[model samples]
Target chain A: MAIPAGITGAAWLLRTVIDARDLTTEVAMVYLAGVLLVASRRSWGPAVAAVLASVATYNFFFVPPFYTFHVADPKFLITFGVMLAVGLTVSTLAVRLQRQADSARERERRTAALFAMTREFAVETSADEVARTLAAHARTLLDCEAQVLMQGPNGDLHPCPSGAPAVDDNELPAAQWAFHYHKPAGHGTPTLPGSSHLWLPLLGARGPLGVLGVQLSARGASLAPSQRELLETYVAQAGLALERVVLAEESARATVAAETERTRSALLSAISHDVRTPLASISGAAATLLEDRASVDESTRRELLQTIWDESESLARLVADLLDLTRLETGTLVARKEPCPMEEIIASAMERMERRLAGRQVRTDLPDEVVVAPVDPVLMEQVLGELLENAVRYSPDTSPIDVVLRREGDLVALQVEDRGPGIAPGEEEAIFDRFYRGAGSAGARGTGLGLTVCRAIVHAHAGRISASNRAAGGAVFRVEIPADAGPGTDRLSPAGAAL
Target chain B: MSPHRPASEHPPGVLVVEDDRRLRATLKAALAAHGFAVTDAASGEEALALAKERAHDVVVLDLALPGIDGIEVARRLRAWSTVPILVLSARGQEQSKVQLLDAGADDYLTKPFGTNELVARLRALLRRAGRGDADPTAAMLIIGPLHIDRAERRVHLDGEEVRLTPTEYDLLAALAKNAGRTVTHRRLLAEVWKDRSEEHAGRLRVYMTYLRRKLERAGRPRLLTTQAGVGYRLNAE
Candidate 1:
């Protein structure tokens, strides 16, 4: 490795050429090195050292007329001035570009981290699952041993296990304090500056979802301020995702509870009214026969049997009503709507209620013109029957019950009016509620689902039914169904209409 | 056989089936005093078994029982039998009457029924059963002094035609058919009301009272007799 004399002179000449280069060029190169050092490692002191050494080397080797500290040419003054200017300019440009690159890289990293966190949160079905996923992600992304501590109602941070050292109560308190304040604490933060763990609040719009406690290793102390900010962003995104999951779960539970309540109410009403009708009749008949056998002579005995028969028929009607209500409420009742004569439906209902309305005087006000409506025949008959029955039960025995049919533009209105005590004030709304009965109408035997059933039927037909006090001292129930074109324009005989 | 006018005459027998021992016993003794041959069974199984052994003109059955509920009993008895089955059940559970009838029970009576009402139902059922297979032209059919003309749907007492409503006439016709047998409440209702509800059995009592008042006008009421808790029976002899 010994050098020869001829090779030594060549080395010296090369050094001379290097020294003779423009001072500004030499300074520019040195400043460029400083900028690169700062961009890669972010060491302020090293960058400053590079700047000083580059300055000193420029003045000593490239500023003078030889290897001396003096300028032999005055023109060299402009060289020194330009060298300083160029050095500062290059340094500023280099620093600005490095900072821009670092910021862009940080944003990309945070965005990817946020996406990953959101994906994890979306797949989690339970609070515990969210907690575990959050903790695991925080540990990996934060590049430190991390723990997710959810604050319990009792103000305790329940640490989720990441298989790392558990965050102590004091550390958790610090984390909770940060969460409560929705700010970061410990380590580089203004609060608890010397602490080892970085306590970041998982802040969301509602509040902090939890706290993320990152325990940095010895090597992790070199994490820059920007790195902490990036970590905080990840924590905030995770918090928002967790909040969304919690809200969704609460709403789902509420929906299920509401559905269950509705089903239970329906079952109770059906069993109480529909199932018991037939049983009541059978019991009544047996009791009468057993009690009065001797007094009831042969002819009289026959009469008692007639009563039993009538009651049995009533039972069948109740069962049918129950089935219809169930089908309607469950959305299974399909209306096979067709253009049918309204008078036919009215006649059918009256015929069915003949025995029930035997004692009461029935007055009809039907126009000679045939009225028609688009409706399901079976359901329409049932609706009319219920309305008539309701009137019979409430109205005075001797009072006249009126059934009026009239056409209102685009709608056919069928009104059944009873002279019974009008529905109490404020009860009009409640009357339609399933199983709701009037206050003074006690001892009235009905399933109380009649009006509700009627409403459902009408709603299915896209029509309306309402009850109100009549202008003339009685309650009037009006059902307005959509008009339709149909045959049967020839009015039937009055006797045929009377049932 | 002709329709017999309502007169002061007693029915023959009635059948009662109830699970409660006290209720059944009380009904039987009461019915026997009313001139009915009161038959009783404590359970649906016992009732079915007894009914199979002998033909009862009328049967009063309770819906609730220890084994094979009353509805099932009605179904089984209806298979080969047209005997009137009257059902008894507690109040507030009136819906079972339809199921019982659909299962072949004729009629129903709610609990706490009056003794007078029970007798009237039995008589109606017995009268209807006795008229079985008889042509409408049968003449001069008599229950004591009461004479019925089937063709005219008329009844006569002491050689005078008695005025009667359509319901009253139908009632008399049912009793004349089952002259000797005890008829339960259910049979009478099934025949008269047809598709009418059993809950309106109270109306039956009102009608029977009207019939009795007309029949007892001569102060020698021999036709209608109350059979306490069981039912009414038309006397054959």
Candidate 2:
């Protein structure tokens, strides 16, 4: 008001002091300056007041009614009207430009904030990381603190471990209810209006995934409509990120389940073939011995009898392997631990395998002192027997098999080496699979259960087993069982002991 | 092998029940040659009928029967008579062993058991049952010209010496001891080594080749014979 008023008074004084009665049209410039000053300094309303004052003052002092309240010339009236129109036009345009600049600035700020949030969301690691990102952004944009609560496995809202505070116990039910119902609750909402925190559900295509609890500043207990809208948008993005995390987890689980099924089916088919092959020979031998007793020569009868015996022995071993797999699957593999000397276990296995390895050279490399460890003797014997059998089966009759036992970094390492063709490239790990045949051995008699059984027994003993191709033209199978450790690795079954 | 089950006073009646038809027939014939009056049955029901209708010294039942398991048969037979139940199961599963033993089976034989072991186990079961008139005890085994004397642990073929390696002698003795029955490869290996091995059953083939060459004179029927995948056997019956 003062700016418009002062500019109008200055123009009136200048017109009076200049003593130029003929400078009537030029005097319009002084009046125009007053209108422009008010438009720039103030709003359009005050500038309009200046416009009306300039028009009236020009009529009273500079118009044809210079001395009287009458227009001496009608042309002077046109001048007064044009001057008034120009003032009004200038003031309106100034205000319109001011509003346009302010709006552009607001839009630019919003776009930049949204872009920052989107970039953060792109590479978010976990549901919790998404929560922190959204929460921090919310605090900045809304000018208030916010807590993000995601639904856990139980469908209850749990705050992320780091960023958000736990939803107060008393208010937890309300937050969960809001997330479940996909509705807002607490302060400013129709429900729970007196509560200090506002809970807004993060709804998605998969229903509500979580909730956002915003803590308003002391300026007011509620957020203005625009701020509330901004909060809703932030929560919506957070919900999307959380949904992505869960979907990724679900897909990974499904893939694992599918892979396990494939492995199980492969193992079953391989076992079935092995079982039938032995059964055919055994049953056929018994039938022939019964039917051809009178006709067949003594030597033929003897041959038939031997067929049944050998097949039955291998069949027994196969059945034992099946039982072992079952026990591992059922988590009932109970090991009876005792201090067993490796030398003793090796000797027992070797002695048992005497008839099988009579002509072959079995070289042994062992440490001098007793390498005693807590293990089930029978199970370890089975492991050694399987490894020795595997070596003999895959390798030629001429090549010697090597068995070495030593201490390796907190473990007792046993390496079984054979000079046969080294494991097929990339098959070092695959050979441990239950159904993985020895592809390297052409027509070798391998059911593939030997190595699988070895791995299982070693793993149950809290050990690691690996197969590697030695540069010396053979494959080395190594088993490292943790030596003399705490009781944590032992699997104790109450029922097994009682039985 | 001489008839261990003597028919001195009255031959003891024995029931043979097995799912495999050929195995059952072979067992019946073998038991008959050993001087026991063997009655054969293909199933548990038929065996139960023979048990009720006829007097038998012992029942040899296979655990894996077509209709009912040997455990159920053992339990049902125990309810009526004091007959000894000898269970022959292919699985040799320890759990089944425990159950069958609890269900009144007097003795259990794992599959591919030697004929000698089967006869010995059954005889021991029968003796305990007090049906001791026909005892099963062999002093010597004679297959054609092949002679095996258990007392001396010696083998004689074709009136000449049939020398054997220490392991070969033990192996031949094990096969001749259970002349007409099956001996598992692992059991035969253990017999040779004096201990069991889960490793190579293939090693037995080398010794078998040697025994076959030594025992088979130019033309006379081969004494020691190969049973393909099974252990060697001397066909005395």
Clashing pairs in 2: A303-B226, A303-B227, A306-B227, A306-B230, A307-B227, A307-B230, A310-B230
Per-residue lDDT of candidate 1, residues B83-134 (tens digit): 8777887533433655675677655666666666677766665666655533
Q: Give the Cα lDDT of each candidate.
A: 0.67, 0.72
Q: Who wins the lDDT comparison? A: 2
Instruction: Return the lDDT, model 2, position B48.
Output: 86
Give lDDT: candidate 1, residue B217.
44
Q: Positional deviation of A193 in candidate 2, in angstroms?
A: 5.6
Q: Estimate each model's TM-score.
A: 0.36, 0.47
Off by over 4 Å in 2: A1-172, A186-189, A192-205, A210-238, A264-269, A326-363, A368-381, A396-400, A419-430, A456-464, A469-474, A481-484, A487-499, B1-237
- lDDT, candidate 2, B142-235, per-residue tens: 6568777767767887677677766677778777665544455556767766456524333454455556556764435445544322234465
Residue-wise C-alpha lDDT for candidate 2, range A188-247, written one tens digit per residue: 778877666788887767888778777763335457665666677778777887788777
- How accurate locally is residue A404 in candidate 1, as Cα lDDT from 0 to 100? 93
